[model samples]
Target: MERRPAPSRGTAVRATRQGDAVSAALAETDAFTSAQDLHARLRAQGAAVGLTTVYRHLQVLADRGEVDMIRRDDGETVYRRCASDDHHHHLVCRSCGRTVEIAGPEIEAWTAKVANAEGFVDVVHTVEIYGTCTICAARPAT
Candidate 1:
């Protein structure tokens, strides 16, 4: 994994109230939530943040490696607060939108070997597996 530069002290101190609110909201859940949904949640909590501010803060957090963004099958982008500092991947449930964090040493080795074989340097990769969870799969057809 490529290391990102630590945020400057000034940058850390300059975090806005809206950004803090957004971060607090995100930290409350492990689900991949859309910006609209997050805005609604903030409003429910009596926060005065707007949808645009939520999106902007989320973008900054994603860029800073503090959050992860993934696309659903419907093409909507969702954001989640990453729980781990070490490298990992997500196993996402298609029906319920539940996510599980997983680490595979073999997958890491394979990725590095493939990248080296292709003469690629400083390679980074993302892997997300999607399937129905047991509970979802066991449900009867509506």
Candidate 2:
């Protein structure tokens, strides 16, 4: 479990307070969710937050590294809780839009080695492995 980056000062304060509806909403959700979906969930939770607020909160979280903001192939931004330990990656299911977390020090080392071999420094990698999820695999093909 890769440790998530720390929340911003603003978010930190909010997550500590009951009325910090935005932070509370985010905290209650699964690791992977869209900001729009999160806004809907917050509304359903009786939080007085708006889509704009959700977006802003998500930006702050992203800046602080508490979350991962990914761009799907279709150009949608998705968010997920950054796990603990700083040693994880994602296994994304293309069919069902689900994501799984995976971690291995060897993978990280390999990435570093590849980057170094290519004369790349401080390289940031985004690796999305696409496949059908178990649910999708188990279901009868349409």
The per-prediction tally of clashing pairs is 0, 8
Instruction: Point to the candidate with the largest lDDT.
Output: 1
Per-residue alpha-carbon lDDT of candidate 1 for residues 54-122, written as tens digits (9 for 90 to 100) = 998887788778898988879999988988978899988887778888897889999999999999999
Off by over 4 Å in 2: 1-20, 27-31
Candidate 1 worst ten-residue window by lDDT: 1-10
User: Over 4 Å off in model 1, which ranges?
Assistant: 1-13
Q: Looking at model 2, report the run of 10 residues with the lowest lDDT sum.
A: 10-19
Query: What's the CA error at residue 79 for candidate 1, in Å?
Result: 1.0
In candidate 2 the C-alpha lDDT for residue 62 amounts to 76
Clashing pairs in 1: none
- lDDT measured at residue 122 in model 1 versus the true structure, 0 to 100: 95
